[model samples]
Target: MPAPAHRLGLGLAAIARPAYITSGRAGELGDDRDVATLRDRSRALLDAAYAAGVRYLDVARSYGRAEEFLAGWLADRPGVTGGEDPVEIGSKWGYRYVGGWRTDADTHEVKDHSLDAFTEQYALSRELLGDHLGTYHVHSATLDTGVLDDGRVHRAMAHLRDRGIRVGISTSGPAQADAVRRALDVRVDGEPLFTSFQSTWNPLEPSVGPALAEAADAGARVIVKEVFANGRLAPGGEDGTEGARAAAALAARTGVPLDRIAVAAALANPWAWRVLLGPVGTDQLASNLAGAELTLPADAAEELTALAEPAEHYWATRSARPWS
Candidate 1:
């Protein structure tokens, strides 16, 4: 396999860290045991993605040294991703890793979407990723967080934009639609500061789709994440649950993997400029690429929308997932 033959407009998430401490399929999949091991795996993953026609890489400051891992991988494989057009590296600030690679840590990440947090994380990201960094996003933007409303943060983002780096925000929680709408209103001297937006849009939580379309119509590129609901759409996950059953039924009817059906549903949204697939290995990545190319039947797509859960309930279940 020389990688997927078609462009999927996909991005890779480098937060496969917790696999270091646990033991199982997921553990093995996320196993970034040490800096050296992580660097090697990161390079392999990135190589696989580029060969497969993926051009975007998404990471975060709190993703347990993801910036460092990506920088090392890029340094080793210069210009290999596609000659004139190289990979685009988009990373997020506003969170810091406190897990210290511990499996028993009470809190693995701490969020702080303040101006000062951006100040520190921005410089740190620059120091680590150097010239490879493209876009910097406010990690997990929520309505109450004020990252989108703060004028000072907007000015700071303006400064970064002046330097030619695209600015954006990643949203989470039940209020994702509200946050995405608010981000669209962010202006730096009467011009929109955000050129990109990433949000969760899976069968479990599809309410944000319209807002994402609004952002796209406003000239911002929309990237869809969590299309599988953080693994809920995969086999061995929520087997007896309604969402799982629905996805499985669709998969069997369409002759696609459950994960593919989940991702394809998200990609079917016209507003999604890029749909991220965070695969733990090359095999999973390949499957995701295939899913990205699928165009689900009109009936199947509409039925998937009916599986949407209340945003509150969906987020509650996601939050309850133990950090692996």
Candidate 2:
């Protein structure tokens, strides 16, 4: 069966539903794992997201300490879920397991979007995700990655559809939008492929937004990522700052936090069916949810758009560094 449209909107999910670890690798913070301890922390994260009315869970085979943690704590998430119908979990395939642990030691992951690898990995992910599955995507996809074009992604995706799952592509480029459009041309369970997709679409980086609009126009539901610009929207840190004052202004005018407006701007786009979110802590999820109110008074939206765009049109030419 197809996923319900009601699942869109404020119902978007937060990625990597757990705290530590990649799929089987070490956690990002490299915390040593005791299944019991992780189970406790994972439950707390999911519980908070659930209580906040989140209905989607986005995970990847490469999220480090996240997917396996979710699988282990699957049944135990009620403490954090707060009695809601279990969340709609969406995990990705297309990478070698590397022993199913979070590849924590490495700051960046290697890309492997091959067919056989994707097929094999997805099968196992299904076993881990079980019944709560709603969407499955290509993890960390780039335009050059063959995952979308390869027969294997579709084959494995087709297999998942046979099992009654909805499949989509997770992309890092505008070209993936084209791939999604192409993927939708084929028949999988009588429905076109890539019913849903995730991509980075924050205001500071508007390159993918138009592509996403094209996808939505073509019938696929688009889920936006990095609405916070991956921490760049926060009070400036390592990266350069361009939109802080504008971000702060929007926050003050709307009574929404700067962090919330980062997300709210993405949510305000009619083409975006849902926006994927991530919070480091349980309370952070609440702050992220503040964006879900989905209200962007017309002037606020315009100013925020202006804030995101610079005099030169993009921030690269500006004298300032990127916002952390």
TM-score leader? 1
lDDT tens digits by residue: candidate 2, 1-324? 123222332211223322221121222323544445544555676666655666667777766556766776565554433454545677776654343333233323446777766767766776776666678887766557656566646766787777777778776543544655555565645667777778766667666667678778878778886666555564331134456556765666666676667776787778987777665455556666766665677887777676555324433432232211
lDDT, candidates in the order shown: 0.77, 0.59
lDDT tens per residue, model 1, 36-144: 6655666677778888777878888887767777777787788744477677889999998887876578878899988899999999999988867888999899889
Task: Tell me how far the alpha carbon of residue 181 in candidate 2 is from the true structure, in angstroms, after superposition.
Answer: 3.7
List candidate 1 segments past 4 Å from native: 1-15, 19-32
| Model 2 misplaced regions, further than 4 Å | 1-39, 77-86, 96-107, 174-176, 186-191, 235-238, 252-255, 308-324
- Give the range of the ten consecutive residues with the poorest summed lDDT in model 1: 19-28
RMSD of each: 2.7, 6.2
